[model samples]
Each structure stands twice: as C-alpha cells, then as structure tokens.
Target: MQSKATTPTEYIHELPDDRKEVITKLRDTILSNLPEGFEETMNYGMLGYVVPHSKYPDGYHCDPKLPLPFINIASQKNHIGFYHMGIYSDPNLLEWFTTEYPKYVSGKLDMGKSCIRFKNMKKIPFELLGELASKMTAEQWIERYESVVKK
Candidate 1:
C-alpha cells in the first residue's frame, strides 16, 4: 500500500468526489466516538484508525507484531467498505454481528478473519459500528482474535 503519513484530513482529501461525501461522513461518525490513543492512518490504501503496537506492546501473548485494532474505511473498485476487527476474533461479537447483519449475511458480505465488507455505506449501522469501536481496546481485541483463531 502507498503510505503517505496518513492523516484523517489527508485521507479524506484523496477520495473521489462521490466517495468523499460518504467517507467523510464515516470518518466523522468514527472520530466523534473514538477511544483514547486511537490514531488515523492510511494502510492498504484505506483509512485506518490504528491503535499502534507501541501503545499496547505487552498486551499480546503471542504475536507482538500484530498491533492493536481499529475500524477502517476503504474505497474499492465497486464500493466502499467498513471493517470491524472484533467480528473476526470475538465469537460473541461475531454472533452478535451475524444476527445484526442478517440483511447482508447471505451472500453479499465478504470477510476475512475479522473484517466486515460492505458495498454500500448505508448497509452498516453507524451507531452499532460506534458501539463496537468503543467496546474493546486494541490489545483486548487482538488477544481475543488470536485466541479464537487458535481454536
């Protein structure tokens, strides 16, 4: 990914006209409710709210390099996606999101270990997204993610 010392403003400035409006709204909702120490960055060509490893170096028992987690906003060929790390690692969180995201669950949503992909911005619940973002620290979320994957 092209890294340019991403700032929230810089990331927003890079978006296309159509995407700028949507991404800006997403950025606003996330920053307004973000927890302390969370940072705005650009990773993998997307806007990432990173909780850097230095912030929680001792939190992970296994992979120390797997820094803290935060939500991400990405622009793709077809649409924009919002990713939530908790969904992949936390069973409780996944179960909750699975139930919460039924409308998009069937064959539309694409996910990796902890990402929720959306083609349309409105498909996600902004309030619920904020709630998820607020619930776990980067360390806590990573530990849970590592633990779940180990099983």
Candidate 2:
C-alpha cells in the first residue's frame, strides 16, 4: 500500500521483508535497463523514475511543478503495481507487451492502460520489464507526451 515515505530509499525501507524483496528486484531490474536521463525518486507514495524539471522545465503538463512521470512501482493493498508510461503512450510497445507477456506469466495479465497488476511477483516477467524500460528514453517519452497533448 502507498506509504508516507518521501524518498525512494525510505519507500523501500518501509516495505515489509517480503514486499521489500519484490520491490527491490523490480527496482533493480528497472535500474539496470532504464535508459539514460530518467531520475529515480518517490512520487505518489511510490518509487518513481521521472524526467526531472531540469530536462523539461515546464514539467508535467498536468502539474508544471512536478517532474514528468515515466514509470512508477508501488506496493498496493491487494497487489503490486508496475506502471509504465511508455506502454500507455506507445501502441507498438503495448502490442509488444501484450504479445510477449503471456510467455512469462501464467496468470491473466491483469492490466490497465499503463498499470500492470501483479498478484504474484513470481509471475512478473523480469526480462520483459527490463526490455520495455530500455526501449524508451526520457526525450522519447517527453516527445510522446507532448504529441498527445497537442492532439
């Protein structure tokens, strides 16, 4: 569940031992494959990777004071959330995910536009997540987000 933690490290620290492991592994996998330019921080009571205001001074269009959110990882009440902006904004990536995910996960790929709900961490496709993260750069995400806004 979302916590009161203000920092990513604190967020990780707040997790119970089991949750810590799951988030840690996910965090590590994302970090290893995350394209250059995104910065990791805490956002919305979860761990987030964002395009800092320094890169896009206007910041998130919805909230100019905040950085542009790229991806988020949160421990929720019933499950874990792996939020991917890339998939939400890019159809090809979403298609790739839909096509490839069944191979790694045994359960239904419970998901929304961007949030992938994981009932069991073991079902998470680690390598696929890594590849997804690696596919988008901060600039690419910014361009995609801006293009959507323009439309």
Candidate 3:
C-alpha cells in the first residue's frame, strides 16, 4: 500500500497493529543486512533503499533526477511486497532464488520478476532475504544496472 508517511519511522508508526511486529522485524533485518552504500528512505510510498546520486551521479535511467533504486518494501492491500532488483535483472540470480527458496518455504510463493508478495509473515524467509540484500554493494549494483541498460 502507498503510504503517506514520509519517513521510515513514520511508516512503521502508521502500520496496522497486527502487521507492525512482522514489518518491524523485516525492516530490522533489511537494515542489518543492507549493503554499506545504499541509503534507506521513503520513496513511492514504500520503504526504499537506493544508491544516492552522490554515488552514481547519472542517477536512475528511468528518472535521471532521482537516485538509482536498489530495493523496496511495501505493505500492499493484502500482503507485503519485497523487491530485489538484482534478481529481476540477472537471470543467474533469479535462478538461484528459485532453486533455493523452496528449501526454506513451504507455503505458496507468490512472486514476480522482482517482487515477492507475502500474506503471512511466517512465510517470509529471513535468511534468504538477508542474503539477497547483502550480496552486492551499491557500486556493484550500479554496474550491473548499467550493463543491463546497455544491452
């Protein structure tokens, strides 16, 4: 769900009481596992981690005025959305996730190219999420993103 909250703290504060604990845990996991150069903030009404313009001056190809996005977390209408940009653009990464996720998950895995939606918090695989989040630094992500854009 698009949130009106402008800050991560505000976002957490406004989350539904029932959903608060899980989201907090997920947020903490993301922060703890996040790569060194990605800054966390609110973007597109979601919790966004981006490679700031100072790091990649070209900014996002889609929107040059904005920083390059690496990942996002959102509370949608009925589920939580976890996005991993690396998996979306790299076939190898996507394959790795598809191959490995089943070992940790038993419930239905509803996922898109970059988005994994979870209705039940218990269904989330924190270990996998942490691994994915920490796999690359902002510089590496920028190189990967640029390489794909060139292709």
Q: Which prediction has more favorable lDDT, 1 or 3?
A: 3
Candidate 2 structure quality by residue, lDDT tens digits, 1-151? 6689988788889888888999999999999999999999988788999999889898887778989999999999889999998898889999999999988777688999999999887787889899989999998898998997524
Cα lDDT tens digits for candidate 3, 1-151: 5899989989989988877877787888889999899999887898899999888899888778888888899888889899888899888888888888899999667999899999887788988888888888888898899899533
Winning candidate number (lDDT): 2
lDDT of 1 at 12: 69
Give the Cα lDDT of each candidate.
0.67, 0.89, 0.87
Best by TM-score: 2
Stretches of model 3 off by over 4 angstroms after superposition: none
- Ranking according to TM-score, highest score first: 2, 3, 1
Q: Model 2 — TM-score against the truth?
A: 0.96
Better of 1 and 3 by TM-score: 3
Q: TM per model?
A: 0.72, 0.96, 0.94
The regions of model 1 sitting more than 4 angstroms off are 1-5, 58-67, 102-112, 145-151
Residue 47, model 1, lDDT? 80
Name every residue pair that clashes in candidate 3.
Answer: 1-75, 1-76
Cα lDDT tens digits for candidate 1, 1-151? 3436357678668767887887787788888877777777765567887767667664334455644545777766676677776666577887776676654334554666666666765565666666667777755755665676444
- What is residue 43's positional error in candidate 1, in angstroms? 2.3
